[model samples]
Target: MKQQYTHTKLIELISNGGEDQENAIRWIYSKSGWVSIVKKMIRNLGGSNHDAEDIVQDGLINFIMDVQKGKIQKIEGANAYFIRSCKNNWLNNFNRKLKAREIIDREFNKEETSINEEKIFVSKEIWEHLDRLLEQIGRKCKEVLKLWSMGYSHEEIAKLINYENANVSKKTKSLCIEKLKNMGLNPDDWKY
Candidate 1:
Protein backbone atom coordinates (compact mmCIF):
# COMPACT_ATOMS: atom_id res chain seq x y z
CA MET A 1 0.00 0.00 0.00
CA LYS A 2 1.06 3.55 -0.65
CA GLN A 3 2.22 5.77 2.24
CA GLN A 4 0.62 9.23 2.59
CA TYR A 5 3.99 10.85 3.25
CA THR A 6 7.12 9.95 1.31
CA HIS A 7 10.11 8.55 3.25
CA THR A 8 12.09 11.76 2.79
CA LYS A 9 9.12 13.99 3.61
CA LEU A 10 8.21 12.10 6.82
CA ILE A 11 11.82 11.93 8.03
CA GLU A 12 12.38 15.61 7.32
CA LEU A 13 9.15 16.60 9.05
CA ILE A 14 9.91 14.42 12.06
CA SER A 15 13.43 15.86 12.29
CA ASN A 16 12.04 19.43 12.29
CA GLY A 17 9.97 18.59 15.39
CA GLY A 18 7.06 20.77 16.73
CA GLU A 19 4.17 21.15 14.28
CA ASP A 20 5.97 19.36 11.48
CA GLN A 21 6.67 16.34 13.65
CA GLU A 22 3.07 16.37 14.92
CA ASN A 23 1.75 16.47 11.36
CA ALA A 24 4.08 13.63 10.37
CA ILE A 25 2.79 11.50 13.23
CA ARG A 26 -0.81 12.46 12.58
CA TRP A 27 -0.45 11.51 8.93
CA ILE A 28 1.00 8.14 9.93
CA TYR A 29 -1.99 7.46 12.18
CA SER A 30 -4.79 8.96 10.10
CA LYS A 31 -3.63 8.53 6.53
CA SER A 32 -0.95 5.86 6.27
CA GLY A 33 -1.79 2.12 6.14
CA TRP A 34 1.30 1.31 8.23
CA VAL A 35 -0.66 1.22 11.47
CA SER A 36 -3.07 -1.35 10.09
CA ILE A 37 -0.19 -3.44 8.80
CA VAL A 38 1.50 -3.37 12.18
CA LYS A 39 -1.75 -4.25 13.94
CA LYS A 40 -2.37 -7.15 11.59
CA MET A 41 1.14 -8.51 12.20
CA ILE A 42 0.63 -8.34 15.94
CA ARG A 43 -2.80 -10.01 15.74
CA ASN A 44 -1.27 -12.81 13.66
CA LEU A 45 1.10 -13.38 16.59
CA GLY A 46 -1.81 -13.94 19.00
CA GLY A 47 -1.65 -10.40 20.33
CA SER A 48 -4.68 -8.20 21.00
CA ASN A 49 -5.39 -4.90 19.25
CA HIS A 50 -4.27 -3.09 22.41
CA ASP A 51 -0.89 -4.78 22.22
CA ALA A 52 -0.59 -3.81 18.56
CA GLU A 53 -1.44 -0.20 19.36
CA ASP A 54 1.14 -0.03 22.10
CA ILE A 55 3.90 -1.62 20.04
CA VAL A 56 3.07 0.54 17.05
CA GLN A 57 3.16 3.65 19.23
CA ASP A 58 6.52 2.69 20.57
CA GLY A 59 7.78 1.99 17.06
CA LEU A 60 6.57 5.40 15.86
CA ILE A 61 8.25 7.18 18.75
CA ASN A 62 11.48 5.35 18.10
CA PHE A 63 11.29 6.11 14.39
CA ILE A 64 10.77 9.80 15.07
CA MET A 65 13.69 9.80 17.48
CA ASP A 66 15.89 8.11 14.92
CA VAL A 67 15.01 10.80 12.38
CA GLN A 68 15.76 13.61 14.86
CA LYS A 69 19.06 12.03 15.80
CA GLY A 70 20.31 12.00 12.16
CA LYS A 71 20.28 8.22 12.27
CA ILE A 72 17.60 8.04 9.58
CA GLN A 73 18.35 11.10 7.41
CA LYS A 74 16.92 10.98 3.88
CA ILE A 75 16.22 7.29 4.33
CA GLU A 76 14.56 5.83 1.25
CA GLY A 77 13.11 2.84 3.12
CA ALA A 78 11.95 4.35 6.41
CA ASN A 79 8.60 2.64 6.07
CA ALA A 80 10.13 -0.85 5.98
CA TYR A 81 12.59 0.15 8.70
CA PHE A 82 9.76 1.42 10.94
CA ILE A 83 7.70 -1.73 10.43
CA ARG A 84 10.79 -3.86 11.13
CA SER A 85 11.29 -1.99 14.42
CA CYS A 86 7.75 -2.87 15.52
CA LYS A 87 8.32 -6.51 14.60
CA ASN A 88 11.51 -6.50 16.65
CA ASN A 89 9.63 -5.11 19.62
CA TRP A 90 7.09 -7.90 19.34
CA LEU A 91 9.85 -10.50 19.04
CA ASN A 92 11.73 -9.14 22.07
CA ASN A 93 8.55 -9.09 24.13
CA PHE A 94 7.67 -12.64 23.07
CA ASN A 95 11.13 -13.90 23.98
CA ARG A 96 11.04 -12.20 27.35
CA LYS A 97 7.68 -13.79 28.18
CA LEU A 98 8.91 -17.22 27.03
CA LYS A 99 11.96 -16.90 29.25
CA ALA A 100 9.84 -15.90 32.23
CA ARG A 101 7.49 -18.86 31.70
CA GLU A 102 10.43 -21.24 31.44
CA ILE A 103 11.93 -19.92 34.66
CA ILE A 104 8.61 -20.27 36.49
CA ASP A 105 8.17 -23.81 35.20
CA ARG A 106 11.70 -24.73 36.30
CA GLU A 107 11.25 -23.24 39.77
CA PHE A 108 7.72 -24.63 40.18
CA ASN A 109 8.92 -28.24 39.90
CA LYS A 110 11.49 -27.79 42.69
CA GLU A 111 9.12 -25.60 44.67
CA GLU A 112 6.30 -28.13 44.42
CA THR A 113 8.52 -30.91 45.73
CA SER A 114 9.75 -28.75 48.60
CA ILE A 115 6.19 -27.64 49.36
CA ASN A 116 5.02 -31.27 49.58
CA GLU A 117 7.88 -32.18 51.92
CA GLU A 118 7.17 -29.11 54.05
CA LYS A 119 3.49 -30.02 54.26
CA ILE A 120 4.33 -33.47 55.61
CA PHE A 121 6.71 -32.05 58.22
CA VAL A 122 4.26 -29.35 59.28
CA SER A 123 1.38 -31.83 59.49
CA LYS A 124 3.38 -34.12 61.78
CA GLU A 125 4.46 -31.24 64.02
CA ILE A 126 0.88 -29.92 64.33
CA TRP A 127 -0.53 -33.37 65.25
CA GLU A 128 2.17 -33.89 67.87
CA HIS A 129 1.52 -30.45 69.31
CA LEU A 130 -2.22 -31.13 69.35
CA ASP A 131 -1.71 -34.42 71.21
CA ARG A 132 0.29 -32.70 73.95
CA LEU A 133 -2.10 -29.73 73.97
CA LEU A 134 -5.16 -31.98 74.41
CA GLU A 135 -3.84 -33.02 77.82
CA GLN A 136 -3.80 -29.38 78.97
CA ILE A 137 -7.13 -28.13 77.54
CA GLY A 138 -10.66 -28.74 78.87
CA ARG A 139 -12.32 -32.05 77.90
CA LYS A 140 -14.94 -30.34 75.73
CA CYS A 141 -12.26 -28.23 74.04
CA LYS A 142 -10.12 -31.31 73.46
CA GLU A 143 -12.93 -33.23 71.78
CA VAL A 144 -13.93 -30.25 69.65
CA LEU A 145 -10.41 -29.57 68.38
CA LYS A 146 -9.68 -33.24 67.68
CA LEU A 147 -12.81 -33.66 65.65
CA TRP A 148 -12.18 -30.36 63.87
CA SER A 149 -8.61 -31.32 62.96
CA MET A 150 -9.95 -34.65 61.76
CA GLY A 151 -11.99 -32.71 59.15
CA TYR A 152 -15.37 -32.82 60.86
CA SER A 153 -17.60 -29.88 59.85
CA HIS A 154 -18.95 -27.45 62.45
CA GLU A 155 -22.49 -28.82 61.93
CA GLU A 156 -21.26 -32.38 62.51
CA ILE A 157 -19.26 -31.35 65.57
CA ALA A 158 -22.33 -29.54 66.96
CA LYS A 159 -24.43 -32.66 66.61
CA LEU A 160 -21.70 -34.86 68.11
CA ILE A 161 -20.95 -32.53 71.04
CA ASN A 162 -24.63 -31.49 71.59
CA TYR A 163 -23.90 -27.78 70.97
CA GLU A 164 -26.89 -25.48 70.33
CA ASN A 165 -25.76 -24.88 66.72
CA ALA A 166 -22.88 -25.02 64.27
CA ASN A 167 -21.90 -21.50 65.27
CA VAL A 168 -21.40 -22.70 68.85
CA SER A 169 -19.19 -25.55 67.61
CA LYS A 170 -17.17 -23.12 65.49
CA LYS A 171 -16.79 -20.70 68.39
CA THR A 172 -15.69 -23.54 70.68
CA LYS A 173 -13.06 -24.57 68.14
CA SER A 174 -11.80 -20.97 67.86
CA LEU A 175 -11.60 -20.75 71.67
CA CYS A 176 -9.68 -24.03 71.84
CA ILE A 177 -7.27 -22.71 69.19
CA GLU A 178 -6.87 -19.51 71.22
CA LYS A 179 -6.12 -21.58 74.34
CA LEU A 180 -3.42 -23.44 72.40
CA LYS A 181 -1.96 -20.04 71.44
CA ASN A 182 -2.07 -18.79 75.06
CA MET A 183 -0.27 -21.93 76.25
CA GLY A 184 2.69 -21.10 73.92
CA LEU A 185 1.76 -23.78 71.36
CA ASN A 186 1.46 -21.41 68.31
CA PRO A 187 -1.59 -23.10 66.80
CA ASP A 188 -0.99 -21.30 63.49
CA ASP A 189 2.67 -22.30 63.16
CA TRP A 190 1.48 -24.36 60.21
CA LYS A 191 -2.20 -23.37 60.14
CA TYR A 192 -3.99 -26.37 61.74
Candidate 2:
Protein backbone atom coordinates (compact mmCIF):
# COMPACT_ATOMS: atom_id res chain seq x y z
CA MET A 1 0.00 0.00 0.00
CA LYS A 2 1.15 3.56 -0.79
CA GLN A 3 0.99 6.27 1.83
CA GLN A 4 -0.64 9.58 0.84
CA TYR A 5 0.54 12.81 2.35
CA THR A 6 -1.96 15.58 3.08
CA HIS A 7 -1.39 19.24 2.19
CA THR A 8 -0.65 20.21 5.78
CA LYS A 9 2.05 17.61 6.04
CA LEU A 10 3.59 18.72 2.74
CA ILE A 11 3.58 22.34 3.90
CA GLU A 12 5.23 21.40 7.14
CA LEU A 13 8.11 19.86 5.26
CA ILE A 14 8.37 22.86 2.93
CA SER A 15 8.03 25.40 5.70
CA ASN A 16 10.71 23.72 7.70
CA GLY A 17 13.07 23.85 4.71
CA GLY A 18 14.31 20.42 5.67
CA GLU A 19 15.75 17.67 3.49
CA ASP A 20 12.21 16.83 2.38
CA GLN A 21 11.49 20.36 1.12
CA GLU A 22 12.22 19.54 -2.51
CA ASN A 23 9.99 16.49 -2.48
CA ALA A 24 7.20 18.37 -0.76
CA ILE A 25 7.39 21.15 -3.34
CA ARG A 26 7.29 18.58 -6.14
CA TRP A 27 4.24 16.90 -4.62
CA ILE A 28 2.46 20.22 -4.23
CA TYR A 29 3.18 21.15 -7.82
CA SER A 30 1.97 17.80 -9.14
CA LYS A 31 -0.76 16.74 -6.74
CA SER A 32 -2.16 20.12 -5.64
CA GLY A 33 -2.61 21.38 -9.23
CA TRP A 34 -0.47 24.47 -8.58
CA VAL A 35 1.12 24.43 -12.02
CA SER A 36 -2.19 24.35 -13.89
CA ILE A 37 -3.67 27.12 -11.75
CA VAL A 38 -0.69 29.40 -12.43
CA LYS A 39 -0.67 28.61 -16.14
CA LYS A 40 -4.36 29.36 -16.49
CA MET A 41 -4.01 32.62 -14.63
CA ILE A 42 -1.06 33.75 -16.74
CA ARG A 43 -2.84 32.82 -19.96
CA ASN A 44 -6.00 34.66 -18.92
CA LEU A 45 -3.84 37.68 -18.12
CA GLY A 46 -2.57 37.62 -21.75
CA GLY A 47 0.78 36.18 -20.79
CA SER A 48 2.70 33.52 -22.69
CA ASN A 49 3.86 30.09 -21.55
CA HIS A 50 7.28 31.52 -20.69
CA ASP A 51 5.63 34.11 -18.50
CA ALA A 52 3.62 31.40 -16.79
CA GLU A 53 6.75 29.45 -16.02
CA ASP A 54 8.50 32.48 -14.64
CA ILE A 55 5.52 33.45 -12.51
CA VAL A 56 5.21 29.94 -11.15
CA GLN A 57 8.85 29.95 -10.09
CA ASP A 58 8.53 33.38 -8.52
CA GLY A 59 5.33 32.40 -6.74
CA LEU A 60 6.90 29.28 -5.28
CA ILE A 61 9.81 31.27 -3.93
CA ASN A 62 7.44 33.80 -2.41
CA PHE A 63 5.29 31.06 -0.92
CA ILE A 64 8.27 29.37 0.69
CA MET A 65 9.40 32.66 2.17
CA ASP A 66 5.91 33.36 3.49
CA VAL A 67 5.68 29.91 5.01
CA GLN A 68 9.12 30.09 6.60
CA LYS A 69 8.34 33.47 8.11
CA GLY A 70 5.09 32.21 9.64
CA LYS A 71 3.04 34.47 7.38
CA ILE A 72 0.97 31.52 6.22
CA GLN A 73 -0.21 30.10 9.54
CA LYS A 74 -2.65 27.57 8.08
CA ILE A 75 -1.69 25.15 5.32
CA GLU A 76 -4.87 23.08 4.92
CA GLY A 77 -5.97 25.26 1.99
CA ALA A 78 -2.47 26.37 1.02
CA ASN A 79 -2.93 25.37 -2.60
CA ALA A 80 -5.65 27.93 -3.19
CA TYR A 81 -3.72 30.53 -1.25
CA PHE A 82 -0.63 29.87 -3.31
CA ILE A 83 -2.60 30.20 -6.53
CA ARG A 84 -3.97 33.55 -5.39
CA SER A 85 -0.44 34.71 -4.59
CA CYS A 86 0.76 33.66 -8.04
CA LYS A 87 -2.08 35.53 -9.71
CA ASN A 88 -1.25 38.68 -7.75
CA ASN A 89 2.43 38.37 -8.63
CA TRP A 90 1.58 37.95 -12.32
CA LEU A 91 -0.74 40.97 -12.25
CA ASN A 92 1.95 43.06 -10.58
CA ASN A 93 4.47 42.03 -13.22
CA PHE A 94 1.98 42.72 -16.01
CA ASN A 95 1.22 46.21 -14.71
CA ARG A 96 4.94 46.98 -14.40
CA LYS A 97 5.55 45.97 -18.01
CA LEU A 98 2.61 48.04 -19.16
CA LYS A 99 3.92 51.10 -17.36
CA ALA A 100 7.39 50.57 -18.82
CA ARG A 101 5.89 50.29 -22.30
CA GLU A 102 3.96 53.51 -21.81
CA ILE A 103 7.08 55.30 -20.72
CA ILE A 104 9.08 53.92 -23.66
CA ASP A 105 6.36 54.91 -26.09
CA ARG A 106 6.25 58.44 -24.76
CA GLU A 107 10.05 58.78 -24.83
CA PHE A 108 10.54 57.43 -28.34
CA ASN A 109 7.56 59.21 -29.83
CA LYS A 110 9.32 62.51 -29.28
CA GLU A 111 11.18 63.57 -32.45
CA GLU A 112 14.36 64.91 -30.87
CA THR A 113 17.17 62.44 -30.26
CA SER A 114 18.78 64.58 -27.57
CA ILE A 115 16.71 65.59 -24.55
CA ASN A 116 17.35 69.00 -22.98
CA GLU A 117 16.71 70.18 -19.40
CA GLU A 118 14.07 72.65 -20.61
CA LYS A 119 12.16 69.86 -22.27
CA ILE A 120 12.26 67.85 -19.05
CA PHE A 121 10.87 70.77 -17.05
CA VAL A 122 8.17 71.36 -19.64
CA SER A 123 7.27 67.67 -19.59
CA LYS A 124 6.89 67.71 -15.82
CA GLU A 125 4.52 70.68 -16.06
CA ILE A 126 2.57 68.97 -18.83
CA TRP A 127 2.25 65.81 -16.73
CA GLU A 128 1.07 67.84 -13.75
CA HIS A 129 -1.54 69.52 -15.93
CA LEU A 130 -2.70 66.15 -17.20
CA ASP A 131 -2.96 64.86 -13.63
CA ARG A 132 -5.13 67.84 -12.68
CA LEU A 133 -7.30 67.24 -15.74
CA LEU A 134 -7.75 63.59 -14.84
CA GLU A 135 -8.73 64.67 -11.32
CA GLN A 136 -11.38 66.92 -12.77
CA ILE A 137 -12.94 64.10 -14.79
CA GLY A 138 -13.89 62.23 -11.58
CA ARG A 139 -12.53 58.97 -10.16
CA LYS A 140 -14.60 56.54 -12.26
CA CYS A 141 -13.63 58.23 -15.51
CA LYS A 142 -10.01 58.27 -14.50
CA GLU A 143 -10.09 54.59 -13.55
CA VAL A 144 -11.72 53.50 -16.81
CA LEU A 145 -9.42 55.62 -18.99
CA LYS A 146 -6.34 54.40 -17.13
CA LEU A 147 -7.37 50.77 -17.68
CA TRP A 148 -8.11 51.41 -21.33
CA SER A 149 -4.75 53.12 -21.80
CA MET A 150 -3.05 50.05 -20.33
CA GLY A 151 -4.25 48.09 -23.42
CA TYR A 152 -6.75 45.87 -21.62
CA SER A 153 -9.59 44.48 -23.74
CA HIS A 154 -13.08 45.82 -23.08
CA GLU A 155 -14.16 42.51 -21.58
CA GLU A 156 -11.12 42.41 -19.33
CA ILE A 157 -11.67 45.99 -18.26
CA ALA A 158 -15.34 45.25 -17.58
CA LYS A 159 -14.39 42.31 -15.41
CA LEU A 160 -11.77 44.31 -13.53
CA ILE A 161 -14.06 47.29 -12.93
CA ASN A 162 -17.25 45.26 -12.34
CA TYR A 163 -19.12 46.71 -15.32
CA GLU A 164 -22.19 44.92 -16.67
CA ASN A 165 -20.54 43.90 -19.96
CA ALA A 166 -17.90 44.67 -22.54
CA ASN A 167 -20.32 47.05 -24.26
CA VAL A 168 -20.63 49.04 -21.06
CA SER A 169 -16.87 49.16 -20.75
CA LYS A 170 -16.55 50.40 -24.33
CA LYS A 171 -19.30 52.98 -23.91
CA THR A 172 -17.84 54.27 -20.67
CA LYS A 173 -14.36 54.53 -22.16
CA SER A 174 -15.64 56.36 -25.21
CA LEU A 175 -17.59 58.77 -23.06
CA CYS A 176 -14.53 59.43 -20.96
CA ILE A 177 -12.45 60.07 -24.06
CA GLU A 178 -15.08 62.48 -25.33
CA LYS A 179 -15.02 64.29 -22.02
CA LEU A 180 -11.25 64.65 -22.19
CA LYS A 181 -11.53 65.98 -25.73
CA ASN A 182 -14.18 68.42 -24.58
CA MET A 183 -11.80 69.56 -21.90
CA GLY A 184 -9.35 70.55 -24.68
CA LEU A 185 -6.98 67.65 -24.13
CA ASN A 186 -5.54 67.50 -27.62
CA PRO A 187 -3.79 64.25 -28.51
CA ASP A 188 -1.12 66.24 -30.30
CA ASP A 189 -0.34 68.01 -27.04
CA TRP A 190 0.87 64.74 -25.54
CA LYS A 191 2.73 63.55 -28.61
CA TYR A 192 6.00 65.14 -27.54
Candidate 3:
Protein backbone atom coordinates (compact mmCIF):
# COMPACT_ATOMS: atom_id res chain seq x y z
CA MET A 1 0.00 0.00 0.00
CA LYS A 2 1.11 3.53 -0.71
CA GLN A 3 1.94 5.82 2.18
CA GLN A 4 -0.63 8.53 2.75
CA TYR A 5 0.49 11.96 3.89
CA THR A 6 -2.30 13.48 5.92
CA HIS A 7 -3.03 17.19 5.97
CA THR A 8 -2.95 17.05 9.77
CA LYS A 9 0.74 16.25 9.70
CA LEU A 10 1.44 19.16 7.39
CA ILE A 11 -0.66 21.45 9.53
CA GLU A 12 1.15 20.37 12.63
CA LEU A 13 4.46 21.11 11.00
CA ILE A 14 3.20 24.49 9.86
CA SER A 15 1.76 25.43 13.22
CA ASN A 16 4.98 24.50 14.98
CA GLY A 17 6.42 27.62 13.32
CA GLY A 18 10.13 27.14 13.00
CA GLU A 19 12.87 26.05 10.62
CA ASP A 20 11.43 22.57 10.84
CA GLN A 21 8.09 23.75 9.42
CA GLU A 22 9.89 25.37 6.49
CA ASN A 23 11.83 22.18 5.90
CA ALA A 24 8.62 20.16 5.95
CA ILE A 25 7.03 22.36 3.32
CA ARG A 26 10.11 22.06 1.15
CA TRP A 27 10.09 18.34 1.55
CA ILE A 28 6.41 18.03 0.68
CA TYR A 29 6.81 19.85 -2.61
CA SER A 30 10.36 18.70 -3.33
CA LYS A 31 9.25 15.13 -2.88
CA SER A 32 6.70 15.69 -5.68
CA GLY A 33 3.61 14.77 -3.66
CA TRP A 34 2.16 18.28 -3.39
CA VAL A 35 3.28 19.08 -6.92
CA SER A 36 1.29 16.22 -8.33
CA ILE A 37 -1.81 17.29 -6.40
CA VAL A 38 -1.38 20.84 -7.63
CA LYS A 39 -0.98 19.66 -11.22
CA LYS A 40 -4.15 17.65 -11.02
CA MET A 41 -6.01 20.66 -9.69
CA ILE A 42 -4.60 22.87 -12.42
CA ARG A 43 -5.57 20.44 -15.16
CA ASN A 44 -9.07 20.24 -13.75
CA LEU A 45 -9.30 24.01 -13.90
CA GLY A 46 -8.13 24.06 -17.51
CA GLY A 47 -5.05 26.05 -16.63
CA SER A 48 -1.60 25.70 -18.10
CA ASN A 49 1.27 24.10 -16.19
CA HIS A 50 2.78 27.51 -15.54
CA ASP A 51 -0.44 28.78 -14.06
CA ALA A 52 -0.76 25.72 -11.87
CA GLU A 53 2.75 26.13 -10.65
CA ASP A 54 2.08 29.74 -9.81
CA ILE A 55 -1.06 28.80 -7.91
CA VAL A 56 0.72 26.10 -5.97
CA GLN A 57 3.41 28.57 -4.99
CA ASP A 58 0.76 31.05 -3.95
CA GLY A 59 -1.14 28.44 -1.99
CA LEU A 60 1.97 27.49 -0.11
CA ILE A 61 2.65 31.11 0.70
CA ASN A 62 -0.90 31.56 1.95
CA PHE A 63 -0.72 28.41 4.01
CA ILE A 64 2.51 29.56 5.58
CA MET A 65 1.01 32.93 6.37
CA ASP A 66 -2.06 31.41 7.93
CA VAL A 67 0.03 29.03 9.98
CA GLN A 68 2.23 31.85 11.22
CA LYS A 69 -0.82 33.89 12.13
CA GLY A 70 -2.26 30.97 14.09
CA LYS A 71 -5.23 30.93 11.79
CA ILE A 72 -4.82 27.37 10.59
CA GLN A 73 -4.88 24.71 13.30
CA LYS A 74 -3.81 21.70 11.27
CA ILE A 75 -3.53 20.32 7.78
CA GLU A 76 -6.42 17.90 8.20
CA GLY A 77 -8.26 19.26 5.18
CA ALA A 78 -5.62 21.75 4.19
CA ASN A 79 -5.14 20.37 0.74
CA ALA A 80 -8.70 21.04 -0.32
CA TYR A 81 -8.70 24.40 1.38
CA PHE A 82 -5.45 25.40 -0.25
CA ILE A 83 -6.65 24.30 -3.65
CA ARG A 84 -9.84 26.30 -3.17
CA SER A 85 -7.91 29.38 -2.20
CA CYS A 86 -5.67 29.10 -5.23
CA LYS A 87 -8.64 28.70 -7.53
CA ASN A 88 -10.39 31.70 -5.98
CA ASN A 89 -7.28 33.81 -6.33
CA TRP A 90 -6.98 32.92 -9.99
CA LEU A 91 -10.65 33.55 -10.68
CA ASN A 92 -10.47 36.89 -8.87
CA ASN A 93 -7.70 37.99 -11.21
CA PHE A 94 -9.70 36.79 -14.20
CA ASN A 95 -12.81 38.62 -12.97
CA ARG A 96 -10.90 41.87 -12.56
CA LYS A 97 -9.74 41.62 -16.16
CA LEU A 98 -13.28 40.90 -17.29
CA LYS A 99 -14.58 43.92 -15.42
CA ALA A 100 -11.88 46.06 -16.95
CA ARG A 101 -12.86 44.88 -20.39
CA GLU A 102 -16.46 45.75 -19.71
CA ILE A 103 -15.46 49.19 -18.53
CA ILE A 104 -13.38 49.74 -21.66
CA ASP A 105 -16.24 48.57 -23.83
CA ARG A 106 -18.58 50.99 -22.13
CA GLU A 107 -16.16 53.83 -22.52
CA PHE A 108 -15.74 53.09 -26.21
CA ASN A 109 -19.47 52.83 -26.69
CA LYS A 110 -19.99 56.08 -24.79
CA GLU A 111 -17.55 57.84 -27.10
CA GLU A 112 -19.43 56.50 -30.10
CA THR A 113 -22.76 57.79 -28.86
CA SER A 114 -24.09 60.79 -26.99
CA ILE A 115 -24.92 59.92 -23.40
CA ASN A 116 -27.27 61.97 -21.28
CA GLU A 117 -25.97 63.09 -17.87
CA GLU A 118 -28.91 61.46 -16.09
CA LYS A 119 -28.23 58.10 -17.77
CA ILE A 120 -24.55 58.33 -16.90
CA PHE A 121 -25.38 59.04 -13.26
CA VAL A 122 -27.77 56.10 -13.17
CA SER A 123 -25.17 53.84 -14.69
CA LYS A 124 -22.64 54.97 -12.15
CA GLU A 125 -25.03 54.30 -9.30
CA ILE A 126 -25.84 50.84 -10.59
CA TRP A 127 -22.18 50.00 -10.88
CA GLU A 128 -21.61 51.24 -7.34
CA HIS A 129 -24.37 48.99 -6.07
CA LEU A 130 -22.95 46.03 -7.90
CA ASP A 131 -19.52 46.73 -6.48
CA ARG A 132 -20.97 46.87 -3.00
CA LEU A 133 -22.72 43.58 -3.52
CA LEU A 134 -19.55 41.99 -4.71
CA GLU A 135 -17.80 43.22 -1.61
CA GLN A 136 -20.54 41.78 0.55
CA ILE A 137 -19.96 38.26 -0.66
CA GLY A 138 -17.20 36.06 0.78
CA ARG A 139 -14.14 35.86 -1.43
CA LYS A 140 -14.81 32.30 -2.55
CA CYS A 141 -18.46 32.94 -3.33
CA LYS A 142 -17.65 36.09 -5.26
CA GLU A 143 -15.00 34.26 -7.28
CA VAL A 144 -17.39 31.45 -8.14
CA LEU A 145 -20.14 33.80 -9.26
CA LYS A 146 -17.74 35.90 -11.26
CA LEU A 147 -16.40 32.83 -13.06
CA TRP A 148 -19.91 31.65 -13.76
CA SER A 149 -20.74 35.06 -15.21
CA MET A 150 -17.65 34.77 -17.40
CA GLY A 151 -19.29 31.70 -18.98
CA TYR A 152 -16.90 29.09 -17.61
CA SER A 153 -18.46 25.66 -17.78
CA HIS A 154 -19.55 24.12 -14.49
CA GLU A 155 -16.76 21.54 -14.61
CA GLU A 156 -14.15 24.20 -15.26
CA ILE A 157 -15.60 26.40 -12.56
CA ALA A 158 -15.71 23.49 -10.13
CA LYS A 159 -11.97 23.16 -10.52
CA LEU A 160 -11.39 26.89 -10.53
CA ILE A 161 -13.74 27.67 -7.63
CA ASN A 162 -13.03 24.56 -5.53
CA TYR A 163 -16.44 23.01 -5.45
CA GLU A 164 -16.60 19.23 -5.14
CA ASN A 165 -17.49 18.90 -8.83
CA ALA A 166 -19.67 20.34 -11.59
CA ASN A 167 -22.87 19.37 -9.82
CA VAL A 168 -21.73 21.12 -6.67
CA SER A 169 -20.89 24.17 -8.73
CA LYS A 170 -24.42 24.27 -10.07
CA LYS A 171 -25.95 23.98 -6.62
CA THR A 172 -23.58 26.54 -5.16
CA LYS A 173 -24.35 28.90 -8.02
CA SER A 174 -28.02 28.56 -7.34
CA LEU A 175 -27.37 29.42 -3.70
CA CYS A 176 -25.38 32.47 -4.76
CA ILE A 177 -28.21 33.52 -7.06
CA GLU A 178 -30.62 33.14 -4.19
CA LYS A 179 -28.46 35.39 -2.09
CA LEU A 180 -28.65 37.97 -4.86
CA LYS A 181 -32.38 37.51 -5.06
CA ASN A 182 -32.67 38.23 -1.37
CA MET A 183 -30.89 41.49 -2.02
CA GLY A 184 -33.92 42.47 -4.10
CA LEU A 185 -32.11 42.55 -7.37
CA ASN A 186 -34.05 40.42 -9.78
CA PRO A 187 -32.04 39.01 -12.65
CA ASP A 188 -34.86 39.92 -15.01
CA ASP A 189 -34.53 43.56 -14.01
CA TRP A 190 -30.91 43.76 -15.06
CA LYS A 191 -30.29 43.87 -18.78
CA TYR A 192 -26.93 42.17 -19.01
Candidates in descending TM-score order: 1, 2, 3
As for TM-score, the candidate ahead, 2 or 3, is 2
Candidate 3 pairs with clashing backbones: 7-75, 11-75
Candidate 2's C-alpha runs over 4 A off are 1-4, 74-76, 110-192
> Candidate 1 on 98-139: residue-level lDDT in tens?
655655676677644345444443554677876787788889
lDDT of 3 by residue, 1-192 (tens): 534556667777776657868766886577636668777777786778888888788878886777666566744576666667777877765665566566567777774423443333355467677778767767877777877765678999999766789998888888887887787664543455
**1 versus 3: better lDDT goes to:** 1
Rank by lDDT (best first): 1, 2, 3
* Over 4 Å off, model 1: 1-3, 111-192
> Residue 130 in candidate 3 has what lDDT?
72
Top-TM-score candidate index: 1
| lDDT on C-alpha atoms for all candidate structures | 0.80, 0.77, 0.70
Q: After superposition, how far is residue 61 of candidate 2 from its true place, in Å?
A: 0.8
lDDT of 2: 0.77
